[model samples]
Target: MQMMSVSALNEKIKSLLEATFLHIRVEGEVASVTYHSSGHLYFSVKDDRSTLRCVMWRSNVSRMRFRLEKGEHIVIDGSIGVYTPRGEYQLIAVQIEPYGRGALALAFEQLKKKLEAKGYFDATRKKPLPPYPRRIALVTAAGGAALQDMLKVARRRWPLVELLVLDVRVQGEGAAEEIARGIAYADTLGADLIVTGRGGGSVEDLWAFNEEAVADAIYAAQTPVVSAVGHEVDTLISDFVADLRAPTPSAAIEMILPDANELLRTIDELGEQMGRRVAQILHQKEERLRREAEAIRGASVLRRLVTLEESFARIGRDLREVIRYRLSQFEGRISPLERQMTESVDLRLRRSGEELRSLSEALRRNDPTLRSKEGWAEVLSEGRRRALESIKVGERFELSDGRVKVRAQCLEKRPLK
Candidate 1:
């Protein structure tokens, strides 16, 4: 053979293979299908004798209707190509179809059915997620993007959540064993919930989710497990066995974290409501006090007492005035009576003095001395007459010194003669 350049030979081989297998269909069973983080599907197609490597770009994978799994018998339409760098022939699957059940499918179904019969999927066996988890254990790769995403989401949602991260292999050899150990350790550490998952990947990349040990560990966990594996369309045995399933690692975080803003808003609203209720109660009490004050004002004991006192004082004044008036009238009547009595006494005294003076005058007028003087005068006249007559008759007279003496009886008889 003529010597050919490596690049030239590679080009010729690539052209020839592309032209020959441009529109060929191959039927086989799927094995080790892995969807990479780069959005490429890589797997092997195998039969009884041989196996071939295959790749399906994400653009074509989106068009596929069925979910692909390991050991699933399928028919594929693609062209063969030679990898110049590695010197390997491979198929670029353009279309895929499910033909029958694969070996891995039979085993998955058998295990699922056995567990279901044993009541593993029973509602009674399933555990509920805690309302407010105190601590959460994350079983995943230590520096994986899924861990960072979960931490970011959890911190933003609920910063107070205690995170216990178990650094372990999420995929490849011994991944399932490490994942099972992580779950057991989380339980021993008394975690509230276990968040285990990885970023989106192919079936082979997420094969740890299919491990019986991982599924059994999740199922046996006392703490609730939340499985977040692969894309939304991907389902794993761990998802069925776990207490809860999330579509992505971020979704698992959201499921476990509480919204801080919503809780704060609720607390604020409760405070406002309590304040309003208290204010209303105070307002009612104030109104009641006002009504009581009005009642007291209307029938005040002090006011009544003052009114009674005033009435009593007025009555006392009136009584005093009446007594004074009566006394004045009595004084007026008594004073005149006293004056009249004094005048009457004076008049009677004057009358008695007048009567006494008249009696004294009569006694004085009829005194004996005056009567004797008058009688002597009369008798003297008679005697003088008689003497004159007797002297003429008897012519007898006795004279002694300058006095005359006359006889009484005999001289009277002579006078009469």
Candidate 2:
């Protein structure tokens, strides 16, 4: 083996790598990425157990369709080269792609995940579309099919609604800025509703609506926004952030505008219903009035009422005549009976008075008081008597008259012989 300087050895290794592994293709995940101020990208590509250094020059990076992010699985198309200064080999990638549906899908998924983590895709953040829009703003590319379709549908649906057009770049470079500015400006214009979209195209052609700036502008708007980007299948970030999503630009117009013809038909139908109701009510009232008139015209009801009134008058006259006759008969009979009773009572009182006087005089003539002067009565002893055996000869005894009293004394005793 011949010994040589490190630079010589590096040069030999560089030649070997270029000659042997030129135009190589490798598949792995991005490990670390550094975008330099010099407009160069330095990164490492890795598998489970090994890593390879890689560099993409600014010139090539400018041509790339997508930016590299850490942990993204990708396939690199380039050649192997050795750096003599570092004595290490690295991949000089000309083109890089996502492992699957390529960088477009990767970029979309990345943005979606980022916005979702920030709660930008939450359903609660969405607002309700206005039921009626007096004025509508259309933010779309100039002369596109989407703008024309919207205009046509709006005119047919509700011609009264004023259409305000703010044409902008729908896709390509600077399209996102233009679309964002249009949304903000339209929000300031006091339009009742806003509809912004473009016709269907490839993901690259529709990428402007998916940009973060457009989504943020739509979210910040005070007026409601309806996003109709591409076909029904094409969903973008703006669609999620806007107040409403329509499958097509024409569909958005349909949502915001009411059909004038249909409204007129409804109004006419209502007027007819009202007329029928009013007619029915008048018919019912007229039928009721006719029934009442027929009842009043009938003669039987009037005849019954007259008969009852005559009966009540006849009863009143008969009651007055009966009371007057009974009073006259009581007056004639009571006058004679009262005079006879007074004469009989006077005769009976005179006879009873004479009989009482005669009886009383007879009784007085037979009374004992007439002879009291001749029939004087005396009592010898009124209260007590004393026997001779108990009295001395000189003892006095009293003889009492009813009017006067005399006292006497016994002086001698006499024998019976």
lDDT for each candidate structure: 0.82, 0.86
Provide C-alpha RMSD values for all models, in order: 51.4, 31.1
Highest TM-score model number = 2
Highest lDDT, which number? 2
Model 2 regions lying over 4 Å from their true place: 1-3, 15-22, 34-40, 58-69, 284-417
Q: Which residue pairs come into collision in candidate 1? A: 35-202
Report the C-alpha lDDT of model 1 over 1-417, residue by residue, as the tens digit.
799988788888988998999989999989789988988899998999999999999999865545678988898989998888766789999988777644345556666776777766776777899888889999999899999999999888888889999999988878989999999989899888998989988777897787778988888889999999877898888888888889999999888778888889999999999999999999999999999999987887897899999999999999999999999999889988999999999999999999999999898667645544454211123334333343443344442211233333324333233
Model 2 residue 106 lDDT score? 71
Model 2 per-residue lDDT tens digits across residues 303-402: 8999999999999999999999999999999989999999888888888888889888887655445433566433244457545444457767664434
Q: Candidate 2 — worst ten consecutive residues by lDDT sum?
A: 370-379
Q: Clash number for every model?
A: 1, 0
Q: In candidate 2, residue 60 scores what lDDT?
A: 89
